[model samples]
Target: MTREELIKNIKSKQSFLCVGLDSDIKKLPAHLLSEPNSIFAFNKAIIDATAPYAVAYKPNMAFYESLGAQGWTALEETVSYIQNNYPDQFIIADAKRGDIGNTSTLYARSFFEHLGVDAITVAPYMGQDSVSPFLGYDSKWVVLLSLTSNKGSHDFQLTEDKNGKRLFENVIETSQQWASDKEMMYVVGATQGKMFADIRKIAP
Candidate 1:
């Protein structure tokens, strides 16, 4: 979706909430396990339950990947369900993929073409070349990982460079060169609330 569309949705919903659907098979409601499409069944119910309050739904890739082909099928069905039922809600594949040029292009095609998610989380540690492949799609988003909400984020993301800029500042600055704000967004952790001022300086 375009930046204006996303902003409009956020305003209309009065929410910026992106519900993370990192559903685990072991944690699913007791009865769903017997169904052939249990994962999708559970996801559809969760989506229905939370649809009123959420403007976006994020499915972490690992949970699905672990189940191999079955997990992938469920994920695909989940995306299709959201698109058909709640077309306005943004869908994100929290894959966190990062690779070299050619491989990154294939990865982008897989997510954008095959699975049809609205956005995908990418890693900027591979630099601009690894990220540009995903920006080739219109209205699709590349959410580059910047400051994370983990303890280890301080280890590198906060490390000062020779220019005195932190690593994440450089990630934000460099990745913007590959894509405009319309197709790009930085993942800032809620824990990094104070650093939002710094992030805005680069993004705004």
Candidate 2:
């Protein structure tokens, strides 16, 4: 979805809620376990229930990937269901995937062409080449990892260079040269708090 469409949806719905479908098989309700595809079944129910209040749905890849082929199938079905039934709602594959250029190209095709998600999370540590491939598709987004909420984020993201610029600050500033706000977004954690003030100064 384009940034305009997403913003319009948020206005029409009066909510910018993006629900995360991080459904784990082990955590599913006992009754859903008997379904032919329990993960998809659980996701379908959640989507139907939350679609009214949400403008987007994010499906975390790890939960499905761990299930192997069956999980992949479930992930596909869940995406298809949302596309068919909740066409206006944006879909994000919360797959923090980033690799070499060739591999990133395949990953881009897999998510943008095959699975057909609106966006996918990407790790920017591999630098621009690892992320540039994903930017080739129009309206498809590369949600680059920036300041994460995890404690370990400080291990790298907050590190300062000789010039005293923080790593996450550099990630946001440098990445802007590659794509406009329409096609790219930074994963600024809510826990980052005042750090968002710094991000806005550079990115806004």
Q: Per-prediction count of colliding residue pairs?
A: 0, 0
> Model 1, range 1-204, lDDT digits (tens) per residue?
778887898999899989998989999988999989889999999999988778999999999999999999999999999999998899989999989789999999999999889899998897888888889798999999999999999989999998899999999988878888889888999998999998999998
Worst 10-residue lDDT window, candidate 2: 188-197
List ranges where model 2 is wrong by over 4 Å. Answer: none
Which tens-of-lDDT digit does each residue in 55-134 have in candidate 2?
A: 99999999999999999999999999999999999999999998977899999999999999999999999899989999
Cα lDDT of model 1 overall?
Answer: 0.91
Q: How close to the true structure is residue 105 of candidate 2, measured as C-alpha lDDT?
A: 93
Off by over 4 Å in 1: none
What Cα-based lDDT does every candidate model obtain? 0.91, 0.94
Q: Clashing residue pairs, candidate 1?
A: none
